[model samples]
Target: MNDMEEDGRRTTMTTTKTRGIRLAKEENEKTDVRKYIPPLDGQYVEKWLNDSQNPGQVGEELVKQQFLLDLLHSKISARYERGLETAEIDEHAWQVQNSITAIKRRLKQLVDTVPPVVSLETTDSRCIEMYEEKQLMATQGMLRADILEERQRVARLCWQLHNTGEDTKEMVNEDPKNDEQEWVERCKLEEAARSALLEEINRLRSTCADLRARLEMEALSNEVPKYDSL
Candidate 1:
């Protein structure tokens, strides 16, 4: 009777082990399927397609096409990462991906596009020259506008200071303590003016940096020949 009980226990243990192995294999297969599948953004595509109420608006249709293209682009990238087979990847898929890439390249040409965060500022003279020229043009335009405004402001401030100074002089003759208090007030005003000037100078410096960056971008765009056009 004890021998029969032992045999029964061993059979139960084996069955449990087999079931565990089967479950693990099933889980692994599911994981493999998930790994092969690509993630996608759907809302972006919808927004692109329905931006305009009228179907006649060409811009909306173009935008919709671009969104679809972007989706295809993402799909292709995901497939590549997932190791999709050439034979498995259909011609239609490639066409959509190609269209997306082509449109993106054209869009880049029309605007001063922001580059990826990883692209560092190049140290090469030609690269630097490109950067500087764009920066200079953008900066000069901004600076000229700013300088004109600043000149007007400075004239107004000077007139205000002159008027305040005359008022202080009159107050000093009326009372000695009043004169001292007026002098302190004047010092405070001067300090505030100095601080404002410093701030303006800093702002100009920042504008200069922005100009330089814009110039560089413009220069780079011009210098780089388009192989597609060629």
Candidate 2:
């Protein structure tokens, strides 16, 4: 009974080993079939077709060559069709890409050419204010000149009156105190007007300086680089 059991176990092990060896051999044979088959080539086909040494096998050779030629022609035709389709798809994709690029370029150009709406509005308003300030300054200058001319004229008139004949000098001396008081008051008023004008001019100069600083800041902000797309 012990010998029978050992023989049975040996038989089972041998059968499994043999089955595995058989399967491995079959797999190797399949691999060799794929590895040994020559790749199709037009030169090889032509050479085979041109051989005429075997007269008895001419008909079989001709049939085999014709089948190979048909298969090669079909493959070439299929490849050519696929190439044409791929080229068309590539061309369409290229055109789409170009259009997108052109659109982005145009948008960038517009962004560069067209100033910001808020900036434009602000610039126009500031320009108008500057013009008004210039006009005011001009008016102030004219008024200052006029006041100086009037003061000079009054001084000339006073000098001429003081240098008049004896009868005119005596008449002027009759109310000299009142005339002196009035002249002092007139000079004070003229000085006050000139001071006020100077103060206004200084204020306007400060305002212009502030405006210039703001404009420079805005220009610097605008100079920053902009992206073509997000």
What are the TM-scores, per candidate, against the unseen true structure? 0.33, 0.24
Off by over 4 Å in 2: 1-173, 224-230
lDDT of 1 at 107: 46
RMSD of 1: 22.1
Model 2 TM-score relative to the real fold: 0.24
Model 2: ten consecutive residues of lowest lDDT = 34-43
Question: Candidate 1 has which clashing residue pairs, if any?
Answer: 130-216, 131-216, 134-215, 135-211, 135-212, 135-215
Candidate 2 deviation (Cα RMSD): 37.5
Clashes of each: 6, 0
The best candidate in terms of lDDT: 1
The per-model lDDT (C-alpha) reads 0.58, 0.55
Estimate the lDDT of model 2.
0.55
Per-residue accuracy of model 1 over 85-155 as CA lDDT, tens digit each = 43333454455444444444444443325442232333245467746645654654565456556666777
